[model samples]
Target: MNLAKNRNEIDPKFKWDIEKIYADTETWNKEFQEIKTLAPKLKEYEGKLNNAETLYEFLQLEEKVSRKLYLLLIYAFLKSDEDTTQNQYQALKSKIQAFAAEFGSYVSFMNPELLSLPEGTMEKFLEEKEELKLYKFMIEDLLRNKPHVLSQKEEALLASAEDIFGAPQNIYNIFSNADLKFPQITNEEGEKVDFTESSYFKYIISKNRDVRKEAFEALFGTYESFKNTIATSLTASTKKFAFMAKTKKFNSSIEYALSPLNIPVSVYDNLIETINNNLNLLHRYVDVKKKLLGVDELHMYDLYVPVIDVPDMHIEFQEGVDMVKEGIKPLGEEYLNIFQEGIDNRWIDVYENKGKRNGAYSWGSYDTMPYVLLNYNFKYNDVSTLAHEMGHSLHSYYSRKEQPFVYSNYTLFCAEVASTVNECLLINDRISKETDKKKKLYYINEQLEQIRGTVFRQTMFAEFERETHKLIDAGTPLTSEELNDIYYNLNKKYYGDKMVIDDLIKVEWARIPHFYRDFYVYQYSTGYSAAMSFTSAILRDGEEAVERYKGFLKSGGSDYSINILKKAGVDMTTTKPVQDTMDRFKELLDMLEAEL
Candidate 1:
């Protein structure tokens, strides 16, 4: 295989043409200077929100500054992800951070001023000014936090703590993706292959136990070595959260987390309970793995071997595009057309290369067409991955086409729904079209793997996060030992019965970067459950469901996220969607058992 390369010759597919962001560096520099000059003028509105004209003027200038700042940051990330070692890209990253900090210095008064208004004055302001009505939600989001909104001096003090709070994510990224190393393993054919960070999952899923053992030991052993340092950084991150929540008068860290998105604690509880009850089915799947592999006992590392051999699932690039198109057809013609437009244009960079960003994502700006970056290997999983990323691209296209500037960007909480819906539909299509018994079984198990990884495993991570934060909120110190104990115990609860709950698994919490991000992992579980319900609804109702889902894609951040999801038909406030998804897991287990 000629494969791909990004070192000497950049694969056209792996490299995004960021020239679209701004024709070149010269244009970006010009815009950067213009935005910097505009920043100082924002101070003109420091004490003047009572005057609509002044407020509107400040907002317009602020918008321009923000748009330019966005362009700079996107370019820096694109360039950095392409190759993190580039000094040019690294310099821009720091420069942008400094500019953001400086910009914060100027506009720090905006939120404070809004909260200072008389209780009902903002409602009247929205009614009076046509321009202000467009920003009504933005204004009220501040007022909603008036109780927690701090004074200017205190807010400034907290704002200066950004880097301290960001330390965990930074440290984890450096160690995991860019720094960690794994030992070489001898495969069944006696060929020695060294493991890279990108190869961790691939190696773990190998049919050979020796390969799995070597990879698991090497990968996690590295983490265990650095456990102390990683634990300290994570503990400090928890302190940052504890401090913020306490100062803001929230009862607990979980309350502070759910309050932002208007989600309830019960939603989290329901997810954990639903998964806990379904573990017998999951354990049954693990038992099947043990029998198939003929292992006396199953370990965590042996979980990924393919039980059913899938034949000729090797799709060419064009065939992958066609499959994604057919799978997403139910999303209606308009949504599909916009998605097709992105594919037809050079909006996607679709192959792997050395030093290219790991994993995949759909990204673009309000000013640009939605674009996807993928590291394609043409495996069956790649086909599903294509559908997943395109789900996000199409969502971005529709959202940008419909929503105004302020509302154009949606929250991370709703981000996975569009992507996962596409994945589910693609899997359903593959299972329907592929007729060979073994191949179909392989596809079914692949779908099962999605539930195992995304729904069940992530919920476990969510539980761990919630538990750790609760400890922190209670004024408990989160030492490395304490974190290890909490993490190892949860590992036992989730995977203990079937697979050995190795003591080494305790270090896993130290390495998980998501713990630094308050209340993020649960979204994967909630989003997967919601997508399953949406997928079933679309299949049964067809056009009407497609139209509503399309409406959801276009909604962007125009409405509250909870309200937006409800309009699209799945509500997170209740547990119906999650229960339905868990039932599907049971059904899938039955099908697999029949095959056995």
Candidate 2:
């Protein structure tokens, strides 16, 4: 019955400790000044990088400044996310962003200069300097984009343009997060409540039909009104990516986006093709939902609220943590110990307050403890989110502890795999233990929805991204009408014949912020598929699998994403992972059908 509370109203224990990164604002500002001062020093090593010993020292200094910059930026961003309306943190975040661009501009000469060195120069340098060997993988990653490095002046120009190119996402964030307003909707109790971005999901999942319909219309209706402006913003972002990619000599933006992570176009293509091949599974899930809800036709708004409601299902935050702990036990005690340390250390911002960010993420630098942001609503799904984010945190913890700072961060290609694997384990554990029939059905619904959203829906998103980029690549203008047609047709194809494809659903493409990110959503599909393999291995093979999985976590950017996943027992080059994931999906559907 309560709405969002003020930040002060939330318990300090539930809030993450930003002070852990910096003791106070003074300390943050001090580090901010230090990074600014360090920014100009990169020029000192501009021409000196060709010398093996000099390059080694320069790399060390670069790492030192990089670590400090990341910590400062993370603190400012996390603080701002806690209360986005706070102008103090907002200014600090902007200051950091500007500083980051300057820093990037200063360091831009390094790669181009290194590439300018004779081709075998790197190999000779690595052979000569022992310290340079530490950066072998790093140097290789840099040289891998040798074709795209451009001249020193050109690279600096591009680097300095970073802030200019970020205008669209920044504009979108401002509109969606701070400015956009939803109309108030009457709830199940006939009480008027203001709908918000954060509350939109909660309302959609409400047991009441009226609440879901009203909230859906109120949310997307606002988007519909602003569709023209939103369309322009998204189109600008798409063009920016296309321009950058073509400037760098890549064929398309998707290749530019995926190449750095060593992901091939075929992997992206295979994910789409495999998902399309299994569209029947998604359609089957939709049919099951329609039957369960007893609706003659399911509307787009009717998709979220579960068909089975468990009245006593309100799970406390602490209970969710405990559930995650037990669910991840198959990963062995050492893994759990590190996870427990993170849980005990206030590494999570556990509840939502006014102006807080809507979704969940695990974020931190190599220099800091892994931190998670969650807006816990005390539902069973929150527990799954907890488990998912903990997976990310643990991945960071292991990577940071094992690899050097340069190799600490993993790519989006492999990032979601760990999180989804944890979700699989958590849902599997809950489903196996539940005794009540309705509650079991509810859990099954939750699991199926996870697959529905992650595997099917995200692949659908992936295809949209691919198609839109291709359209731009082929010199076709992306008008709002064309974007809508593409999105609605795909929506219809994925959802199949059981549901009513509302006209308003066509406007949904204008609202997805990820479209601005350029080919980012496909990883959720691929990562989920890879995670299915790891989850099956962990459950069936036990300790050996856990150790291999641990190795994969620690590998980080030490190797390419595919190789890392391969070492972790998932061979993504073949369609086997996707097919195996579909098998798991059907197996769950069988269980849900038997339970019903």
Candidate 3:
């Protein structure tokens, strides 16, 4: 658990090869200027998209310029996240962000202009030039969103306001990652350690109750002190969603957020409804947690502590990678090859460092290898995170290989499916192979926690987002008090009477980064449910299911996320998948409780 205090102190091999995107910042700067020069050319084709030849040429040039722009943008983003405290990389990130906004404004006319073409004009263009066929799905999707497409002038105005719209999220990232500080806390070994956002997970899961309590209070206590400031940023972000949704003629911010992926509002509704019906299962889980911990009262800090301890189980990073590769063997050799390639090529940045961004994510452009960032702490959960993010990376790899740039990026709704599938497989593999009763119980507990954290916890978040957005849509200001009350109540309902919902946990919403991304967290719940279905199928049906699952990953954004998953045999449009997940949860709970 030795952490690097500076980025330079970390082993180079453990870092992602960002040089694959750009050899140096000077090269990034050169391409940045090139894109700036080429972006203005997009304006030349405005009001002329009705002609088939002109439309095809415009799309080609636009794609070429955009590919370069994203490459530069991704480079800057990776550089900035490496150390948020570095002003040079921060400036580099800012430059690309501003240019990207300008680029968005430049291409703003294309959608509106395409929509304004004569009825049957796009069909005629597609029939005339074979090249335009490549953009058929792109054009059709645009037509589907015709009601939401604003005028060229209006679209340009919104596009120009991209940076302004992004300010709240940007402010939150800087404030949390760079400016905010957590007080030092003593570990289980009586060593005073720097408590950080990344290390908070480590401390909260400490075997020592006092250590866990101290870290929990220290973390939330700091957030509580700045609750008003974080509340302002969150409120502003919600208002931004409301404004855009209203401007775009949507019924609500959730509709606006889901529309891009063509997700039905029912999908979001169904998740909340289904999970609400299953609250008893979560309450039972809380009861089990209380009993297993042998506590008179279970608090928020006690939730993450492992009730079944396997003290000797420490997974080094490479061992975790090996376990992941072994766990995913059901996917066959090709998937394993690609996973190993990512490892050999240094596509992952492993370990925490000073000023590093908290949590883990997989990101890359179509032209580059999918890269992952992690704050690896040698815990079993960190191992699962490695498997989860590599799941995303491999999905991106397959999608980019199989589809064109336009369709390479999958929707967020489908994004978590691949990641969660890997996690489910890895945990199940661990559980199946372990002979020791205590270790097996530990894995079972991990699986149960996964369900609780993913399906139950995230659905709670989705509900919170729904409640807050409704307030904004109704012209109600989201003050800190209102937000805190809403979150605290949801915790009580979800966790039930078995556990104590601490007042400090009320300020917890202020610390969630996903709150800034409107209507996004719900997918984690749906995705996990879908993954449970997929994992069950793959393990039960064997290669037939694996092929279908891989096909879904390769399909990417070419179809609606729901349809893609439907083709893969799990239909997210209904509540069956969610119900199936709950059934599995109950089975796991039954097993864990019997063992206890």
lDDT, model 1, position 325: 86
Model 1, residue 592: what's the lDDT? 72
lDDT of 2 by residue, 1-596 (tens): 13688999988888888888998778999888888888688778878887898998888888888999999899999999999989999999999999888888777667778899987899899999987899898888888899887887887788789999999999999999999988999998999998897898988988888899998899888988998888888888999999999999998888899888888888989989988999898888888888998889899999998787764767888788899988888989998898888877899998889999899999999988799999999887788899999999999999999998888989878989888889889888888998988888878877788888888988999899889889888888988888889999999999998889988888898778888888888888898999988898999999999989999999988999999989888889889889888988888889988988
Worst 10 residues of 3 by lDDT: 1-10
Candidate 1 lDDT over 446-540, as tens digits, reads 88888988888899899888888888888888777888888888877776487777667788786667777888899999989989989988988
TM-score, cand. 3: 0.85
Q: Tell me each candidate's TM-score.
A: 0.89, 0.88, 0.85
User: Alpha-carbon error at 191 in model 1, in Å?
Assistant: 7.9
Which candidate ranks first by TM-score, i.e. highest? 1
Q: Write down the lDDT of every candidate, Cα atoms only.
A: 0.80, 0.88, 0.91
Candidate 2: give the clashing pairs. Answer: none
Candidate 3 backbone overlaps, count: 0
> Least accurate stretch of 10 residues (summed lDDT) in model 1?
6-15
What local lDDT score does residue 145 receive in model 3, on the 0 to 100 scale? 91
By the lDDT metric, which is better: model 1 or model 3?
3
